[model samples]
Target: PAGAGQDQTFRADDEPEHGDLIVTEAGVLKVLHTPGHASNHLCFLLVDQQLLFSGDHIMQGSTVVINPPDGDMKAYIESLYELLAESVRYIAPAHGFLMGHPEAVIDFLITHRLSREHKVARALGALTPVDLKALTAKAYDDVPAAIHGLAARSALAHLLKLEAEHRAFREGDLWHAIHES
Candidate 1:
C-alpha cells in the first residue's frame, strides 16, 4: 500500500520526470529512471536506510544488457551521476550481493558499459563490417554461449546509440560501420 510497486509500475509516465522523490511508509525513496538496461528500468533509493535497490539497474556478477528503443547509454550515465550525488551507502541489486560501497559499484557498472562501447568499436574494426550476431560474439566472448543472445541485445544497445550518433548503421538484423562525418 504505502511502499509498493506504484513507484515502479508507473515509471514511464511523463508526468513524474526523472528526479521525483516518493515518500512511503517504509522510507523515503527516489524514482530514478535509469534506462539503457531497459526502457522502463527504475532504481529506488531507500533514503533513510541509505540502501539502494538497484533492481535490474545493476548486479554483482553480470553486466546489465542494454537493448535499443528501450535503452539509452546516455540516460544511464545521467542516472549514475544522480545516484552518486545521493551518497548511497549500500546497494541491494536485483540479482547480487549487497554492495558495501555503493559508489564503487555504480562506477564499475558505468565503466564496464563504456568498455562495451569500445569493444563494439574494436569488433567492427576486426571485421569487414559485420552484422549484430557476429559483432555480439566478438564483443561478448566472455559470456556463455547460451547467453550470447543476451549479449546481442547489449550490443544492439550500443549500436543503437552509435547509429544515433551516426557511427553505425543497421539494415534488418545486420549492422555496418558508418564513417563519422
Candidate 2:
C-alpha cells in the first residue's frame, strides 16, 4: 500500500449525471452514481449491451466490505437496489471474471448484509455498553479469530450505521443500544 497513495488530488469539475452518456467505440457507457462501497464510487453501464462495469461496488465471489467512516451499509444496500432496478445482463467487476445472474447475486448480497446487520444489532442489544472487540466476538462468533481484525472493522461499521439510524449510541470506547419509546 506504500505506492498506492497519489501525490496529488484532482478536482472533478465535470461529473456526469446519473444517466449521462459516454459514447465510445465499444458502446455507450451510462454513468451510474453508485456510491456505497465508498462515498464517491461510480459504475458505468453499457446501454446497448446492458453490461455493468462494477468497480469495487460488486465483487465476484464476495460481498463488498462496507467499513464505516468510508463505507456505508445503507447506501450500499440502496445502490444495489438501484442496480437491480436497471437492466443489467452481465457484471464486469474489478476483481472477478465476467459473470451472469447479476440480479440474483445482488439480491443475495443484500440479504447477506441485512442479515449481518441484524446480527450486529442483536449482539449490541445483548451486550450493551460493550467495547468493539467484545461486540465483534459476540457478533462474529462464527467467524475465525484469524480474521477477527477485519471482522471487527465490519462490526464497527454496522455499529456506526446503527448510530446513524439512531438505533444505537457510543460512549467513549463502548457502544450501547438505544431503547426508544
Candidate 3:
C-alpha cells in the first residue's frame, strides 16, 4: 500500500520553498528545508506551539535509512544541528507518535550518528581497500545480518561523508581510510 498512488499524477497549486510560511486555521507553519534524508526534504514548524512536523527528518522509535545518491550523511547531520537553533518542543514525525524534549532528541540523534561514523572510520581503518559489504560488516556488526543490505547503504553514506572530509578515499569499488602520519 506504500506506493498505491504511484500511478496517479497529482499537481500542487503552490510550491512552497524553504522559509515559506503557511498559515492554517490551526497555526502558522514555517517550512524548514531540512535536507539529507532526501535532498528536498522539508519540515514544517508550528510557530505558535513550538512543534515541528518532522517528515522523515526525525523518527520516533527507529532511525531512518541514509541511502546515498539522494541521502547525504553530512547534510543530514548538519540539518539536525540547524534544528537546535529553533524553538522546537515537540516533533510530529512522519512515522509514529509525537515526541517531546526536542533538543534532547536532536542531541541524541547527532551523537548516535557521530558514534556510528566513528565506528565506520575504525572499521575502514582496520579493513582498508575493502568493499562496501566488508566495511559494513565490520562497522555494523551489532546490526542483524538480515539487514546488512540496508546497513550498507548508510555505511556508504558515512564513507561518502568521510571522503568529503578527506578522512577516507575510494578506488573503484573499494574504500580506503586516510591515516595521519
Candidate 3 lDDT tens digits, 1-181? 1147675566668888988999999999999999899988999999999999999999999898888888999999999999999999899999999999999999999999999999999999999989999999999999999999999999999999999999999999999999978
Model 1 lDDT at residue 156: 78
**Against the hidden true structure, what lDDT does model 2 obtain?**
0.88
Clashes of 1: 0
Best by TM-score: 3
**What is the number of backbone collisions in each predicted candidate, taken in the order shown?**
0, 0, 0
lDDT of 1: 0.77
Let me know the TM-score candidate 1 reaches against the reference structure.
0.77
Give the TM-score comparing model 2 with the true structure, all chains together.
0.91
Tens digit of lDDT per residue, candidate 1, span 101-172?
Answer: 877888887787788888997787677368888898898888798988877877777877777778878777
Q: Please state the error at residue 42 of candidate 1 in Å.
A: 2.1
Rank ordering of all candidates by lDDT, starting from the highest = 3, 2, 1
Top-lDDT candidate index: 3
Q: Is candidate 1 or candidate 2 better by TM-score?
A: 2
Cα error, candidate 1, residue 72 (Å): 3.5
Each prediction's Cα RMSD? 5.2, 2.2, 2.3
Tens digits of per-residue lDDT, candidate 2, 117-149, equal: 999999999999899999999999999999899
TM-score for model 3? 0.93
